[model samples]
Target: MSRVSRRRFLEDSLIAAAIAATWAPSRAESEGSLGRKVGPNERINIAVLGVHGRGLDHVKSFAKMKDVAVVAIVDPDSNCFEKAVKAVEELGKPTPKTVQDLRRILDDKDIDAVSIATPNHWHALAAIWAMQAGKDVYVEKPVSHNVLEGRRMVEAARKYKRICQTGTQIRSAVGSREAIKFIHEGGIGTVYLARGLCYKRRDSIGKLPDGPVPQGVDYDIWLGPAPKRPFNPNRFHYNWHWNWDYGNGDIGNQGIHQMDVARWALKKNKLPNSVISLGGRFGYEDDGQTPNTQLAFMDYGDAQLIFEVRGLPTPDLLGVKIGNIIYGSEGYVAFTSYSTAVVFDSKGQKVKEFDGGGDHYRNFIDAMRSRKESDLTADIEEGHLSSALCHIANISYRLGSPQPFNPRTKAFGDDKEAYETIGRFEKHLAENGINLNEATYRLGPKLVLDPEKESFVGSAEANALLTREYRKPFVVPDKV
Candidate 1:
C-alpha cells in the first residue's frame, strides 16, 4: 500500500500557503466586468459544478439570488445541461455556458465563485483547484473522501484566504440554529450526549455485470481522485456512495450533517480522544462495499457522540429518524429537520418548539461579498471536523476486530461491550433475514487519537486508510 510521504505534504502546503497572497483572482479577471470594478452592488458571477444531481439545485439557487449570476454550468455528462439551463431560464436568468470539463471552467477569470455538488470523491480536489485558481467555493457534505483530504481542503481555504462553504445547510437553518442556541444557554443544562441518526431507507443495489462506458460520459474525468477500475453502475452516480473508492457510504453521505450538529452541541471543535465502530452491510449481497447498517462511537472525555446509520427499515431513535437528539442534565432537544426542532423535559414531555429557516447559499454569498470567512454559515473548518469523524469510524471498521477496551482508560483492551454491540448488530441483520454465520460483523478497535494531530495512536495500518492513492492530474495534492 502506498503511504503519503511527509515530503509531499510539505511540498503541497508550501505552494498553497502562498497562493492566496500571489494568486488571488482580481475583478479584472471576470469575463463580464459589469462595466466597472465589482462593488457592493455588482453581481457575482459563479459556476455550478456537477449538475447531474445536487448541482441542479445549486444552479437554480444562485440564479434566484440578488446580485448573483450563474455564468457557467459544469458537468462531466453533457445531457445534464439541458435541464440545468432550463432551470436557469425559467428563473428569468440568462443561460450559462455549459461545459463538461471543470478545469476548463477554472481557467476563466470572470468567474467569482463555484458551487460544487460532485460525488464525494471529487469534492476536495475541486474545491482546492477552484481556490488555487482564485475562486471562492461552495462544496457539498463530507467535503472530502478521506480524513487527510478534508484537512487539506481546510488548509487551501485558509492559506488562500478564500471563502469556501461546506454544504451542511443545517448550520444556517434557523430552526437548528435556535435549538442549538437554546442548549448553549443552559436550556438543556450542560449537554452530555448527542446521538445522530441516519436511518434513511436504502435497498440493495444487487449485483450487476460490468458494462461499457455510457456515451457522452468522460469516464476518466468522472473517476478523478479515485483509482481507475472497471466501469459498473453500482460504482457510478448516486450508487457510488456504497463504494470506498468514491464515497463514505451513508454516514459520510447523510450522517455527517447530523454528526456536525452533534459535535456542535457538545461545543467541541477538534477530533475526539478516541473512536470505534461496529456493524455490517445487512439485508442482501450486492456490489456495494460499504456497510448499510453501522454504528460509530466517539469519546470526548466529558461527553460522548453516537451515530447510527440503518439502511434497512427501523424505528426512529427518540422519535426522530435522520436527525439529531442532544441529551443534557435538564432536558433533551430533537433536531428533527433542517427547519424544525423540539425541546422536551426530563420526563420526555414536549416543552418547547422551534421553527426557522435560512438559505446557506445566500450565507456564502454574504461572506464572499464581505471578504470575511468568518461570515460563512458552515465554514470549511466545521465541515472538516465532522467529515473526519466519518473517516475515523470507517478506518476502525476496515481494520478492526472484536476486542475489549479498558474501562478506566477507555482504550481497547477488553471486549464484552464490543461483543455485545456486535451481537445486537448481528441480531439486527438477522431480523432482516441476513445470516451472520455466513458473514459476521466487523468490529473496529478503540483507536486512541491525538485530537490535535488527527492520527491513530500507534496504528500505522489504521492511519494509512486516512488517505488514498490519487490518480494523476486529478490528485488531491498532499501539500494543498
Candidate 2:
C-alpha cells in the first residue's frame, strides 16, 4: 500500500476501534439540510480540537453541559489526550475517544458539531472543513489568522448554512451587553474614540535552539497551513503566539476581545478607512518575531479606534490594564473584565456599574438547534471584522520602517487624540528603561483601505499581507 494510504488506513482503523469502544449509535440522528438543524432535546455530539491551553477549557465547559456530548478529543499532540480524557470522566461523563488528526472525525455522521480551540492558524481550515462536512462550529476569537482567511470562513458559513459562532465570550456577557446598550443610548454621549488596551505583561519565550520534534506529536499536522520549518521549542505549544507564521501576536491574542467590544460600540459593520501601527519587541531580546510593545491607530472618519499592546511591566491606563475605555462627549465607559464594566461621567464621577455573565457555549448550542445565524451572539462575520482589524494593523507594522523616537509626527496631522496617544507611547517606552535617543521604533505608513472590498488601496506590499501563501493539502481554499 502507498505511504499516504497506509497512514490513512491506520488512522481510520484507530478511530473505528475507539468509537466502537466509547460511542453508541443509538443517539438521535441529525436531520435537516446539511444536518444544520438539531433536535432541541437531543444531545448534540461535538469534537473538541486542540486540547492544549484554551482548548482544555472548551472540553470542561462542553462536558458539563447535559445537552452536549464531547464524543472525541482531537489534537496533534498525544500528550494532551490524558488530561482531556480525565476532564470528561471526572464529570461523570463517558470517556471521549482521542485522535491526533481532526480530518479523521470530519466524515463521522454521528458527530454533529466541532468546538475549535486550535491555534489562530488552524482555526479557519478546521472550521471550514467541519462546516463542509455538515457540522456546526464554535471557533475561538480572532477567528482567522488573516483578513482573507476570515472572509472565507464567513463565506463557508453562509454557503453551508451552518451555525458558526465566534469565541468572543464577552459578547454573551450581560454586563458588556448593558454597557454597550448604554453607550449606544447616549449614556456615553456622542461616542468619538475607543481605546483597547492589552497591557498584560508577557515574559520572553527566551532563546531556544531548534530541536527534534517531541515524541507522540504529529509535527506535520501541528504545522497545518503554516510553512514547514525546523521544530523549535519556543514555537511549540503556547509560545506559538509569538511567531508571525503561526500567530498574529498579542493584539490578535488577548486584545481581540477588547477590539470586538470597541468596534461594537462604534456600530461599525465594516473595515476602517485607514490604519497605521508602531512599536517593537523591546526589553530582552528573544526568538519572538512579533512586537512586544505596539500601538495601532485606525481611522473611521468621524471616530477612531486605537489599540495598545504592552508586554513589559506597566501601570494600568484609567484603571484598565487589559480592557477597553470608550470616550464620549458626556462620559466614558470602562470595561473592567470580560463580564463587568463601569460608567463614569465626564467629571470623573462614577455613575453606574454592570456585572453579569452568560454561557457562550450554551448560546452556540442554542443557535445550532434553531439553525439561525442571528441567534449567535458572535457570528462568523463579527469574528471576521474584528480579526481583520488586527491583521490590517499588523500588515502596516510589518511594512514599517524604523525611525528614532520623537513625540511630534505629521502622521496624525492635527488630530489631538492621535498625537497625545503617540506621545504617551514614547513616554511609556522611556519609563520602561528604553533610551529614546539610541533606540528606534517601527513607524508604519498610513495605508488607506477600500472598506467595501476590504483591501488596501494603491500599496501592493500592504495588500499582499491580507492573506498568506498556504502549504499544500493544508491550504484554506481561495473559494472555500
Candidate 3:
C-alpha cells in the first residue's frame, strides 16, 4: 500500500478499536420515502457524531423528533459520550448505543441519516463519507473547513442524491425566511450591501502543557485529517473553535450564520469578484490561532457584502444585536440572530417585520419526513457559501503582515487599532493579575483576494494555509 493508504488504515484501525464494543445493528424502521407511511410508528434511525459542544443539542433535538430515532452517538471524548448516553436515557427511550468512531455508525445499514456536529475540520469528511455510505446528512454550519472542501461536499450530495442539510438552523426561523423573502421581493429595494456582525469578547485558552493523550480519548481519531500536534487542552475542547488546525475561528464558528443570510438575501451563489480583509488577534495572550477582529469585503457585480467579526465576545458590537442588516436604496431591515426580523423604509419608518418561530431542528425533521429538499430552509450549499465568506476573510487577513513591534520601546508602530487591540488585551491581563505592559501584537498586512478562487491572488503561503494537510486514512475523496 502507498504511504497515504497505510496511514488511512492505521487511522481507521484506531477508530474501529475505539468503538468496537458499542457498534450495533441498524434500527431504521422508516419507509422508502419520507412522506410515505412505512409504518404506523416508523422512526428514522439516525447516528450522531461529535457529541460534545453542539452535539448535545443535536442529540436532544433528535430525541424530541417523533419520527427520528437516534440509535448511535459517536465522540472520541469519553466525557461527551457518557453525558450523551445519560441524556438519551433521561429521554425515557432506549439507550442510544455510544461509539467513539464515526465509521462504526456509518457501517450500520440501519441508519437512515447521520447528524454530524464535529469540529470544523471534520465536518466535510464526515458528511462526504456518510453520503458515500448511503446515508442522508445533517451537518453543522460552515459545511466544510475550506472552500474546496465545501464544493466537494456539494458535489457529493448531488452525486449521491442525498438529502444533505447544513446546520444554519437560523435559516429555518420564520422571521429570517420571511425577511429574506421581503428583501427578494424588493422590500429592501435593491440592497447593495449586507453587513454581518459577530462581535463578542472571548478570554484566552490559557497556556496548557502539552502531554500524553487523555484516558479514554482517541487522540488520533480526534485529530482526524488535521495535522498531528501535541495534545494541548486549549486546542482540544471548545477552545478549538479559535484555532486554525481544527477550527475556523469566530468567522466560521458564528459569523457564517449571518453570511448565509446575506448571500441568501442577495441570491448569489457563485464566488465574488474580489475580496480584501484585515484583522488580527487583538486582545489577550491566548492560544487562539485566529483573529480577534476581522473585516472582509466581497464585490458582486453591482453590489458588495461586508463581514465583520469581533472576538471580544462581550459588549455588543451593534448595540447588543449581532445579525445581518440589509442596506438598500430605499430602506433597510435588521434580522436578529435568532429572534425576529424588523424592517424600516429609507425614512427609518417601520414597514414590516417578522417575529420568528423557534426550532430549526424541528424544521429539519419536518423536511426529512416530507422528502423534499426545499423543506430544509438552509441547505448545505447555503452554509458552505456563508462559511466560505469567513474563510476568505481569514485568508486575506493572514496574507497581510504582522504589525511591526519595538521590543526596546514596548510600543506598536503608530497603528490606530493596533494599539487599541493591545490595550484590550492588557486590560484583561491586569484584571487577571498579569503584567503585559510589553507584549508584541503581530497583525497581518492588508491582502487582496480573488473570491472566484477563494484564495489569495498574490501570496503562496497564505493560500497554502487555506486547505489542511489531511492525515492519512482520514482523506476526503475527490469525486468530481
How high is the CA lDDT of each candidate model? Answer: 0.83, 0.90, 0.74
Model 1 C-alpha lDDT per residue in residues 233-256, reported as the tens digit of each score: 888889999999988989999899
Better candidate number, 2 or 3, judged by lDDT? 2
lDDT of 2 at 152: 92
Give lDDT tens digits, candidate 2, residues 69-141. Answer: 9999999898999999999999999999998878778878899999999999999999988887778899998
Per-residue CA lDDT of model 3 for 278-320, tens digit only, reads: 5567656767788766766677868777776766544543332
Q: Clashing residue pairs in candidate 1, if any?
A: 12-479, 13-479, 29-109, 30-110, 31-110, 404-413, 404-414, 404-415, 405-413, 405-414
Better model by lDDT, 1 or 3?
1
Model 2 gets an lDDT of 0.90
Off by over 4 Å in 3: 1-41, 313-320, 403-463
TM-scores for every candidate against the unseen true structure: 0.88, 0.94, 0.83
Model 1 regions more than 4 Å off: 1-37, 402-427, 435-439
How does model 2 score by TM-score? 0.94
Model 2: CA > 4 A from native = 1-33
Deviation (Å) of 19 in candidate 3: 10
Provide backbone clash counts, one per model. Answer: 10, 0, 13
